[model samples]
Target chain A: MRRMSWFNATSLTLGFVFLYLPMLILVIFSFNASKLVTIWAGFSTKWYGELMRNEAFLDAAWVTAKVAVASSTLATVLGTMAALVLVRAGRFPGRTLFSGMIYAPLVMPEVITGLSLLLLFIGIGLDRGVLTIVLAHTTFSMCYVSVVVSSRLVTFDDSLEEAALDLGCSRLEAFLLVTLPIIAPAVISGWLLAFTLSLDDLVIASFTAGPSATTLPIKVFSAVRLGVSPEINALSTIMITIVAVGVITASLVSKRAAVKRRNEEQAAGRA
Target chain B: MRKFALIALPYTWLVLLFFVPFLIVLKISLSDLALARPPYAPQLDLSAGWQGIKDFFGGLDFENFIWLTTDDLYWKAYLSSLKIAVISTLLTLMVGYPMAYGMAKAPEEWRPAMMMLVILPFSTSFLIRVYSWMGILSTEGYLNQFLLGLGLISEPLMILNTPVAVYIGIVYTYLPFMILPIYAALDKLDGSLLEAAEDLGCSRFTAFWLVTFPLSRSGMIAGCFLVFIPALGEFVIPSLLGGSETLMIGKVLYEEFFNNRDWPVASAVAVVLLLILIIPIVLFQRNQQKEREAGQ
Candidate 1:
């Protein structure tokens, strides 16, 4: 038993090291004053300063932010509706095909999807640019958002909407007044997920994006191919910090919400 | 009325934008390559006319499909991609399972922290992570530096710009993918069953093999497919680390479409890849449906 515990602890520690040590090193070297990625001379914020000064990097970052916001917002709206239909609508002809179509992009190789879309755009006389990137991003992003929202919808009790309807409210009113409020959290979470996916995507973006429409991931990818740089590390560190903050905040908010609900139930019981 | 429109609108958008493009690719794949044009026009049977009443067999050729099978280059790349994907997936499973098991056994408070550690790296740019491997595996990079510092080697090993580098890059990027699903599965595992096994005469290894491993098979399968399929289609990692000598299908397809400007050939290559991937895709979807049904 003791031997088993030791083995488990060792293996787990090794696993953690495997997963993290490289990231830790990258973060550390981001602050290194040396230009060479391997040799760390001394700690400095000069690479970050260089990143701020570089107009190309800033432009790419701005493009990425815009794409994430635009694509994710559109995805959230479309996905919510798709989820509603999938979960609430009665049997309809071709429902299986619709479901398959919605989820197909999730598993289909991004390269194939990108290639197919690129071909379609050319066939339609559409140029490869930001518009193409946004359209492509929206395609897969909506699927993810729908999956998240529909999963949340599955747990929702139909009785709440039905009760509102029973009180002489129209179906639309009931949905707006009851169902919409209940699933609002799901919509927001789905949007966040969509945003992150859009921001992180590279392959599809590479295929769809024109020279003028370089997103941050594509920029970083090209830079990495040329050679590793401290500036890229600086950029990575900043991005990691942002994602970590978002995740931590989301967890805390959810935990707080759970506690508030529990306390309200207790108060109601006492009353 | 508004609700009906709301639901109908998105489905229409998906059909027009998503499904149409795929249909176009399928159509083009079946058509003969248009010679002497930048955008190769797909061969069409105008003899069928507007009504399109004709034999389905007469419309398209399986020449592209035949080419994919007979062509030595295509077969070689496909085989190499399969071999790499399988080996890397197996390595990921071996490494990930123990870590997931340990995470599952950790104190409740620690589980979230561990999960965060795993997912945090994922949230960062994948490009950077793959790039980071370059710095580590390069001839004069950290791994060589550390080894040289330790007097482990007289000269820096030539690890970069090889198939081994491609393998390392792939395995590094995909390890988290294998870890997360397995961890989720093990996290939801019932402790009582393991306790029962222990109470009975089962040893720890026997109990894990008989009880935990079988129970976590779904997660294992999910993780493997997720890693394997994507790894097979991977372009960036191999492009960056595999150097010029290594030839994977994704890179080949990219060169065909962009460099050589051969859309028909690229489409043919893609059709072949889709065929190879169809089995895993079906299996994954079926497993997901089963899970959903079981959940409900």
Candidate 2:
């Protein structure tokens, strides 16, 4: 209702700059020919070439991709189930416990989660490996997906499912055909979110991963700990570009779908 | 039968993976450190039946918890972690509130893009985001270099590896968490209500203070908890950006577990950290439950 105040404008400008300037600096330095990150050197793709030649980093990236794919898929299925139970099941037994377990991971610190999960694996005699890492990721990322999907489920129109059931569809078919299609966007976004989270996670993975299975973040973290180098910068820049592109595309698709859905709804209203 | 399946599968998974782990951590915290394979004493062998159970119970003690209290470093780390978390949450709220307000007030068409800008950084790797700060906060980093270039300072300020850098890292990383929730609340606010306040002879600023601020209180609390809880146990920011003098519970727990190879102490630290976090977390859960009820 009100125009953008000068205060709000200044705040937004400053806030965005604070958020993006470090990333901008990191990207710019990734192209530097000099070994040092801060120094200005002639433009070069040497670091990117070097990253390509580094086997460990490549291996780490491969491991990360596998973990992301496997974990996110499992998280999505489990999370979708959790969201449905939370939204549609009403006050089932242990409802509070179910909700608590679902939401706890969202705010639980990585150190605690990592430590606790590691202990669980150790206690259960499960070997620390790629499988353990996937399990850990799935546990935490499932919570995130539940949060995303549950929000969508809350706003969802249940009448459509009711309508489907009234039209002689079975309960299962009503959900599969009507509810699932409508909430597919939220589910998809939830999967992508879990994928990114699993990919990006370093702490939990570090704790659970065996000696043979280092993820990319762990690799970069140890290398960066040795000090800033242009090669790591190059690797980081690549990772940033991939993630940024993925997020932007997902948002654009979702936004377009939302607009189209609204238009159809308006047309139906008129008819 | 189908409803039972839907609830049973995920519920069993969480109980096995999520809930069981915490129980294990608690059990481990009570165990004595040993030079054994699992690095703890009196292991619980369920296959051995009653004898193994008795051995496990016999070995359990409060020695690690006692040791935690005896160590000044552990207590100091916990205090400093809480201090940093509280201050950073406040800072994020201050920075995020105006930005969220702006986004909520912006043209409807631009809102999605604005929301995307906020979510993009979040979807990126957390470690890289912190790493980017290292390049900007180091003594020879970008910020100091820029200031030096502009003649604003005679020397490169030692911003990196300092507590201030940790603050910056926390605020930068958690700003989106603060903003998004607040924006959600503000966006849902009735424009007519603000107009009503103004029509009753209130200034626009007072209208916001009285009407908008109170309505957005839930979001602010939610945002603060979201930022504060994880930040308290944050390991990366403190380890990478903070100076040696900087102490946080997460770093200390890490050192105890890995460097010192002391699982019992680390578990004890974790238990304490969780105990401290319980209050805010329960409050957050209550708020979420209330919101869910309101929505339904």
Candidate 3:
């Protein structure tokens, strides 16, 4: 038993190291004083300073932020509506096709999707640019949001909506007043998922984006082709920290809600 | 009746935008290469008429398909891509499985923290993660510098701009993808079964092999397919780390489409790539259905 426990601990520690050692090294070397990329002469904040002042990176960052926000918002709305429809409506003639179409982008290679969309846009004479990027991003991102929202919706009790309708509320009013509030958490999570996906996208963005429509991923990819710099490291570290904080906060809040619900049920049972 | 339209709206949008585009690609892939003109026109020539129809039906050429199969370059690219993808998927599994198993067995409080660590990397730009590798693995990069500083080597190891670099890039980029699904699977694994095996006087190794391994196979398979399929078709990492020497199908397709201006050949390659990807996807779907049926 002691031997087994030791083995388990060793395996776990090794896993943690494998997952994080590269990232830890990345964060450490971001502050490396040398510009040669390999030599760690000492620590410095010069890279972060350089990143702040880099005009092209700054512009790309701005573009990425806008695209993430806009596409995520669009995806959330469309996806939430789609999820509500899929979950609430009875089995229809095209239900399988609808579900398959929604999830198809999830598995399709990004290159194929990007190329096909690029072809479509060109065929229609719509120049590739920010609009096309957003459109492409939204197309895939909506699938993710729909999957998340639909899974959440599956656990939802239909009686809540039925109860509201019974209490003289119209279907729309019942959805807004009851169903919407219940699924708000799923919607928020779906939105965040969409935002992260849009921010992280590269391949699809590469195909759809024009010269003036570079995102942060595109900017970094182009820059690395020339040669890597510590400035890129600095940018990555900041982005990782922000995402880590968001995920941690969201998980904690959700866990607490679960705990609260369990406690409430226990109390009601005792009463 | 009104709600029907509301539901129909989103489905219609997806069919028109998403499904139609794929159908367009399929149509283009089937059309003659000669008919491909600027502004994206796929013309059907009836001059050859019945012979062309017979050729199409009989699979006389499949011109593009035949080109892809007969060409040495295409076959080499496909083989290289398969080799890289398989090796990387195995490496990811070897590294990721132990970690996911460990996380699954950890204290509940620590599980969330550990899972966060895995997922946190994904939130950042994937291109940056790949770029970060360039800094670490390059001859003048930190790894060589650190090793050289320690007198571990007389000369910097030539690691970058090779197939090894491509492997490193794919593993690093897709590690989280492998971890998340496996972690989820392991987390949901019933501990009582392991306890039962131990109670039955089974050794720890036997217990895990008998109980945990089988249970986690789905996640393992899912993770492997996820990593392997993308790695096979990946263009970016190969383009970046592969330098000039590496021949990857994704890069080949990219050149065909963008550089060579051979849209028909590009379409052919895409079709073949899609066919390759579909095999794993079908197997995955079958496994999922079996699991669902067993659950019911």
For this target, which candidate reaches the highest TM-score against the unseen true structure? 2
> Over the stretch B74-113, how does candidate 2's per-residue lDDT look in tens digits?
9999989999999999999999999999999888888888
lDDT of 3 by residue, B82-167 (tens): 89899999998988888787777777677777777787776766776777778778897777888998999989988889999998
Q: Each candidate's fnat, in order?
A: 0.60, 0.79, 0.52
Q: Is candidate 2 or candidate 3 better by TM-score?
A: 2
Candidate 3 share of real interface contacts = 0.52
Give the winner by DockQ: 1 or 2. Answer: 2
Cα lDDT tens digits, model 3, A1-271, are: 1233676689777766655667777888888998876666898999999999999999999999999999999989889888887787878888899889887788888888887787678767788788889988888998999999999999999999999999999988998999988898899999999999999998889878988789998888777788777888899889878877888888889889889889998999999
How does model 3 score by TM-score?
A: 0.91
User: Which model, 2 or 3, shows the larger DockQ?
Assistant: 2
Instruction: Fill in the DockQ of model 3.
Output: 0.53
DockQ of each two-chain model = 0.61, 0.71, 0.53
Who is ahead in TM-score, 1 or 3?
1
TM-score of chain A of each: 0.95, 0.95, 0.94
lDDT string, candidate 1, A161-257, tens digits: 9899999999789988999888988898999999999999988898899987899998998888887789999998898788889988987897798
